[model samples]
Target: MKFFDVFLKQFRLQWRQYLVASLASYGSLCTGMSMGWTSPVLPQLRGPNSPLPEQPTLQQESWIGSLLVLGGLIGPFITVPLSKHVGRRWLIMGSNVPLLLGWLLAGVTTNLPTLYVARLAWGCATAMQFATVPIYIGEIAEDKIRGALSAFFLLFINIGFLLAYAIGPFTSYWGLTACGGIISLLYLPFSWYLPETPFFLVFKGRLEEASSVLQQLRGKTKDEVQPELDSLQAMIAREYEEEPKISDLWASRGSVKALGICVFLAMLLQLSGIDVLLFYMEELLAKVGTKISPSDGTIIMGVVQVATSCVTPMVVDRLGRKLLMWTTSLGLTIFLTLIGVYALLDNYYKYDVTSVTFLPLLCLIVYMILFTLGVGPVPWILVAEMFPLKTKCLASGICSFMCWLAGFIWTRFFRDVAASYGIYTAFWILAVCCGIGFIFSVALLPETKGKTFDEIQDLLNNRTKQGNPGA
Candidate 1:
């Protein structure tokens, strides 16, 4: 059978579960919508068609960008605590209120202070998303399709981005803000139709509700779900066996192991210099003496990014996570090395280097495609998959917190690091980090392609029992 035909047949068996996916993916869409608006709207604010009487000064623009990060630093404080007590479903739905308000705030006011507040609100919405959605998907999806489903978080993120880039350039100021309002409004009913994850219900000791939801999710009769339900109960029982004592840094040997992987993946995602490529593509291209316009270079990179995202959900289950991550990290190392070498020759060695200008652009294009294939989506999936139920709430919170913290520090210091050390030195640093990350991934990253949540947790606990065959 053809691929779409086969996929549709599978969809028939599991379409409701995918409605769950659709609900989860709206967070990603909201996130991408927020991200996409900034690029187009910022220019509109400053252009001859200024929304305000006076355009924002350069410092104001810079703070507007950084304020989101500042609010992002704080947003998880709300999500981590509230999500643990209130459950995943509402926090996701609650995140949208901010998204709607933030955009509406933008639509109504051109005031910088109000814009700053809206940007902060949007940042919180983004954090709520990164914190909640993957865990929900991990809890609900069957092991057979977990990687692909978790990947929807990222696929929709880029789709939001592409939609913003494609549509925002042409739309009016009010229309741009309306876009976010529309997505937020649509998410309400779609999210309502989805079930709360069985794990959450079980964790709360609502066993009957848990079983009912699991029956709906698994599309099996109660007798068929008994073994799976038992596994979930056992996992939950063990997790709450005693009130969990908070370790210093919440460190259990098992959690430490899981955290080490989260840290490495987070580091790989940020330190691969993906941010440098995205935010400063044009500037870097100029430094390399490329004839390509910054806009064209950015457009090319964006196209390659969206194109590569499509490749993962199809192949991740087939090829597995470890191979793709290792390959992409290694690829990043190679391309970054080439770009760094070219920069080295140009700046310090005084090689005119005009002839090889295309090399850096080529390296960036290939580097972005490779980056999207693995580093972009896999980390979030691993974060969702690797934790035990006992620690899933706190562990995911800390893990995502560190991610935002890393992003803030990296973006803040990257320019200083470049200015003080020179751009070639910066690329070389990112290249060295990628080279080291390749070794780290090879040594420690878990292969989670087909494993159940219990199996992955067992691996974390260093126990050696076979998982439920049904899982």
Candidate 2:
């Protein structure tokens, strides 16, 4: 009842903000579909009903999954410069081009190389959406609701995952691709109606237009929004004074420290086995030897992910970032280690673990829940929160690149490693990564739940003393 009351109050206060943020995050939904496509499609491609003339080799299969990450590598580069020139809104709208093309090409392709090309195209759009959506949402939302709105990005992505998992096994290859295309088409039309973010407008010296947009976003009159409009102007001025060049990212000890934190978190996010789970969830379920079929298991996992993703938006500001990371990272470490132990005993020792078949699925569900609550959503939120406006694009791009690069390496090699050693080895490695993440949280992670950009910068620059992280 209390949660609902708070939600209603926020909705009454910022309905327009909610509406706009939701629309921007729809791009994340498309990326989720793109990311989830490989899981169900891989089995079909490698099986007897392949769309291609020949089945992909194991190497080609790895490429098919990692190529999207490769394409994402270019997305930040495209977004960084273009976002300033064209604005985040147009950049997001423009991404539909590659998105539609990728899905259409994948739907129609008849050969392996063409399919790879199509995945790469989809990957490009995926990264573009991810890079821009959080920034757009972050800029438009009020500080009180910013964390919640930012969580919407990942929530929609999980929703997309659920859509793909639920629909892909039942649909034809072309049918699945058509669904993706239609999603992109729907996004294009609705996104045209989205207002340009006031922050960007102010940055471009359109203060009056920025004020008007803020009026709509805040549901306030010119007088009501003037203070915030003035704040935006001042923030932009400070940014301009700082000369937001890429070099500015390293110009101060604080800036360098913030970059290191963002980079480390980004790496931790991918290294925690998210890509492996996203790309090969069905396969992993098969290895688990659960009572449920892999398709059903994947869909169930997706549902859990979507549901758990809802929790962060509700409680992130209340609970704070570091607490969620610490709690979830510890949970993930334990759950992943448990899964590893299961795989070790069952696969290596060849135990008759039929009675405990439920263990793997149970751990996986909990893992999905914990991940969506923290690891899946928090890093992206920090990406938007940690940097100032001038260096945001550069910093975001670098972090996004680092993120996908790690994902590509891990995802590309996961199969080889699992085959060479055991699947238990893979799970254990991810467990170790999660453990390190927990340590990182305890030792160095900073809190930014409700802080303004100035306060955040101050904390990072050490202009303000925060409680000792180790203590």
Candidate 3:
């Protein structure tokens, strides 16, 4: 078949699956809005753009930026258990409802408490995104294309952030938020049409439905899909035979190892200081003597981030996950070190580096480029791919919770750290963490590049002792 026809053929039956994943990503887009809104909106609030009775104090401004993490703290508890019971589609639907409400609320509300509630709502939605959307996409995707599709989740998120960065400056705060609500509305139909994963259907003893879904998603006949159905039945039978308890997640060596990898990656993700770079782009740029205006710097940063992230979906399956992880982590370590060295000389030693004013911008651009290449998207993909079916939801939820916890702690304290110790200190800290992450990830992260769900779990569980396939 011609490549174009082959591509069309792939989508003919699996279009709905792809559509659902795309739809689910709008939640991430809204998340981008939540992330980018604060940068522009904070300046407005400090002035007289909205109905805020007065300019916010520095403490309040910090809270406004970090308060979303507070909502992240609560989302998984509500959706983790709920997703297992109700369904990924509805949970996704339910998650976005709050996003819509939060954006709408932020668009209109004048009260500080109400504004705080809106941030919390956005946080809750973001947490749920990390918990559920990836699981849905992972379960539905064929292993060959799964990496690319998984990258879509991050792609939309960056797009959302870019939208806010690009448009937030030009529009009113209310108008920017209204755009967020519209994205939620656009996603609803796609979510409405999404099918439950065949794995979930089979586990529920809906064998016929599972068969039908497999046929549809695989673009194959019922006869062709029966073997897959039978495999699910066998897997389900084994799962029921030896169901894992929540308390015993760590009892199994493989489970513990898998969870460790997930959590470690999560910590590495935030510790890289992307959040600080993004959240404090304006302040950091001005302090670093970047030649560009802060607002333009932020927009440029957002654009670079989005552009670089686009490479992943194309190269992920082809180049594989491990390469991206270690290379990018090491790359981040190097760039961050450059940034730290520059800032240290410029800030503490009173060295006039004005001639190299563009150095910080060069380092930041490289930092984001390296970040989007792997560390930004791979951890979430790993979370979705590594866990056994029995513990998938629970493991993903817990890891997401911890990831956000890291986010919360960093977002809340990084400013203080920068204020007291200097941004150089923060940069150096991030460099050390990224360096360690590069080492650990290279040493420990198992490759899941082209494995089916069964194959991935089996590799993790040590069932098919090919003596370490990734190595």
Candidate 4:
């Protein structure tokens, strides 16, 4: 087929999927702003004309950044149970409550307690969005485009980060919070219109509803959608033959393997130090003595981040997952090492490195670019891709929880580490982590691009191991 003819055909078939996925992904966007909020706002909170009752101490600022992730710890527990009952669509809509409240409160609050509560609320919503959005997108999208739709979860988030980076530096504290709250509020009304995932509907015994949703998602007539609906019914029937338990997550060797890979990838994502770079973008740039102002530096990096994130959905399927993972991880390792060496020579050795003063910012911009490509999006895509529908929510929740837990610990102690050792120590540690990630990508990660879920399960189970066939 001609390229445009193929593009038009796919768009006609998948537009609804894209629409709902984009709507659901707004939550990820809001969560991104929440994550990026600290980068610009925290410095202002510590400045002379602080917005709070008093300027926040270093400890309090750390709490502000880390508490969002700490709140993420409770997300999976709530989403896992509620997702089965209320369904993924409503869980996504309901998450807006916390996000809206969090932004509203953060905008007006004067006291530390109230501010921390706002951050925590953002965390809870972040967890919920992470848990439901990917799975919903996974179930609704055709296998061919599933990787791209799933990657949208991270793409929207980077867009939000860019929004925060661009907006926060220009606006008042309340103004920034107001924009976030407005986005959260807007997301709720449209969410009510999104179709529930057919997987969830079928699992809930709403077969007719499941078929209708599948038809809508596929942009197909009832007759055309029947075969796919039948497939979903059979898969759900087989998977849910017995009531699914938390134990079902490991019922098969494949399921167990999927969970292990997901959890490890989740941990690797956070430990690679994206959070420190995000939550402390301004500070990190300032410390590195970049000629560009810190806020300007963050905006520059944010622009690169969003731009690079846009490329992933286009290339992910064509290039495949493991290759992207390996490529991005290796790039991250090299750039992170460069950043560390720059910091060490400039900060510790007091070397005259003015000739290469631009290297740190250059490394960071490239780091964010490389990170947005694979390390940032692929793990979450895997979370949605690798699990059976029966245990998807629980498995995804565990992965999301692990991701945020690592983020909480890593971001919380980052300043302490930088203070006690040196800033170079922080980047070197992350570089080492990314190097390990490169090894894991080569050795442990499997290619899931364009595979059906059953086929993925079979691969995980080693049912077909010739040349790792799909790999």
Q: Which candidate do you rate higher for lDDT, 2 or 3?
A: 2
Q: Residue 169's C-alpha lDDT in candidate 4?
A: 91
lDDT of each: 0.75, 0.88, 0.81, 0.87
Between prediction 3 and prediction 4, the one with superior lDDT is 4
TM-score of 1: 0.87
Error of 3 at 80 (Å): 1.8
Model 1 residue 327 CA deviation (Å) reads 1.4
How close to the true structure is residue 414 of candidate 1, measured as C-alpha lDDT? 65
For candidate 2, the 10 contiguous residues with the lowest summed lDDT are 462-471
TM-score of each candidate?
0.87, 0.97, 0.93, 0.97
What is the TM-score of candidate 4?
A: 0.97
Cα displacement (Å) at residue 405, model 1: 0.8
lDDT of 2 by residue, 1-471 (tens): 997798888788788888999999998898899889988899888777778888888889999998998888989989998988899999899888888889888988999878888888988998888789888999999998898999999999999889889888998777787888888788888779888889899999998999999888888899999999998888888778855687889988878988898888888889999888988889999885667899999999999999888777888777888888999999999999999899888888999998899999999999989888888788889989988788888898899999989988999998899889999899999999999999998788898888888888899888897753223
Cα lDDT for residue 31, candidate 2: 80
Kindly provide the TM-score of model 3 when superposed on the true structure, using C-alpha atoms: 0.93
Residue-pair clashes per candidate = 0, 0, 0, 0
Give the 10-residue window scoring lowest on summed lDDT in candidate 3.
462-471
Candidate 2 ranges beyond 4 A from true positions? 467-471
The sequence of per-residue lDDT tens digits that candidate 1 reaches over residues 34-142 is 7656655666778777666688875576556555555576667877678658888888888887777777777777578888888778777877887788888988988
